[model samples]
Target: MKVKLASSYGFCFGVKRAIKIAEGYEDSATMGPLIHNQNEIDRLKTDYNVGLYNNLTDVKPKDTIIIRTHGIPKNDLKDLRKKDAKVINATCPFVTTPQQIVKKMSQENYSILIFGDEAHPEVKGVKSYGEDQEDVHVILSISELDNINFKYDKIATVAQTTKKKETYLEIVNALILKNKEVRVFNTICDATFENQDAARELSKEVDVMVVIGGKNSSNTKQLHSICLENCQDSYLIENAKELDPNWFKNKNLCGITAGASTPDWIIQQVVDEIEKY
Candidate 1:
């Protein structure tokens, strides 16, 4: 079988930066999983003795806290400050752009509409930027736009940094049709768009596609979704151990792609293992 990898895959600038920051500090703990990939987190834990805390309550004032790339809510930052914990803000700059825009637009009385999953940490952080969290709306699909009942003359929309550009644009178009005045910012990261496009292209050329990344990673999931849409035999796996040799038994070509948070070493390992088959 011929194996091909997406042109754009693995750690993006933001994730690399976050990892570098985390590596620089000793006796530090991340506010959450620094990035979604468990393998890298495990490596960091074993090599640097980094700790992961789900909430501030578990962190001590003396311990250095590294914020995850998917930033925390505004109130959570305040709470961290109150606790006097040493903080290393590793929030991706791309994610911060939407947060600033949402806060500014909300302060100006524009209704905020975030085009992303409500449960996602990045989306939750963006939602917290609104003047009133109750007024802010998070819509994952065009259909969800219908559920918004706020009577605002002006609406401002932003998307999660890892969201698909096409999906974001589709939601923005729908918002324009439903609202009188709509201000939209394409908050989706450039790398995400490129990665998705590359994955789609790679999937089309291969008989079976393997998407590597953390299952919980939004960007990785998006990649898998795009791959599946283009290729029927696409599979999503966190590591090479999850790979089933049977999937490649009759396949002539295999495509590989990974999420932004995935490390190069892991991707390489997957590639090596697949080649063995």
Candidate 2:
């Protein structure tokens, strides 16, 4: 019945900073999903009544628009400002690096490829940075790289900040197969890499793995995937209440890991609940 938790299981610095900014911005609306964690988002809504708008076109002139940590494109900023909406830039500094690199790569006429979940908010923003020009494509996985038909003479790649290093490297190696001149920014955030590494290590030694985070959380899903790879006894849940005690039947050395967006309190609650059983 013993339980072990990964040291890197809680909110990463980037997610903490983004949430702090959101907490401070009272009476404002985020331009998109503030964080992947629904529990935190639900809390924010209950306390601050903060709103979310994917399209700023209908935003009230007096409302302030906060950009989520994942960030938005340059054109979106211009348009928001033109609409007389106050723009709060909550973009994680790590995410900004890839955006800057994409801009630089586009100017150099090198074929640009972004490696990450194409449907993710981070990847969507990265894509926007290159959408103005026609030289960019996004590859979410190593398998997607085969579809890219760009010339090998000039190529550049960047990863979403929350991607696992293994997946990122897999896609990078795929690109290398087709192009020798490929440039990579290694844009994956340090926090994400540490969290995944810790989870992977824990999964190897644990009898069962519990990944705690919102279902919408991309990084949490990745962590769960990593756990499943290392140990089949892996489950993803948003809260301790969602966990069924029967799943741990006759199991020991339970491993618990949370996503970057998960708050410490939720993690502790889950761990405490597991201990109670």
The estimated TM-scores of all candidates read 0.97, 0.92
Alpha-carbon lDDT, every model: 0.90, 0.84
- Across 88-200, the per-residue lDDT of candidate 2 in tens digits comes to 88898888889888888877778888887778878878877773355678776677766767743678889888776777788777777767688988888888888999999
Prediction 2 global C-alpha lDDT: 0.84
**CA deviation > 4 Å runs, candidate 2:** none
Worst 10 residues of 2 by lDDT: 131-140
Error of 1 at 181 (Å): 1.6
Top lDDT prediction, candidate number: 1
Residue range 29-110, candidate 1, lDDT tens digits: 9998999999999999988988899978997877899999999999999999889899899999998999999999999989
> Which pairs of residues collide in model 1?
none
- After superposition on all CA atoms, how large is the RMSD of candidate 1? 1.2
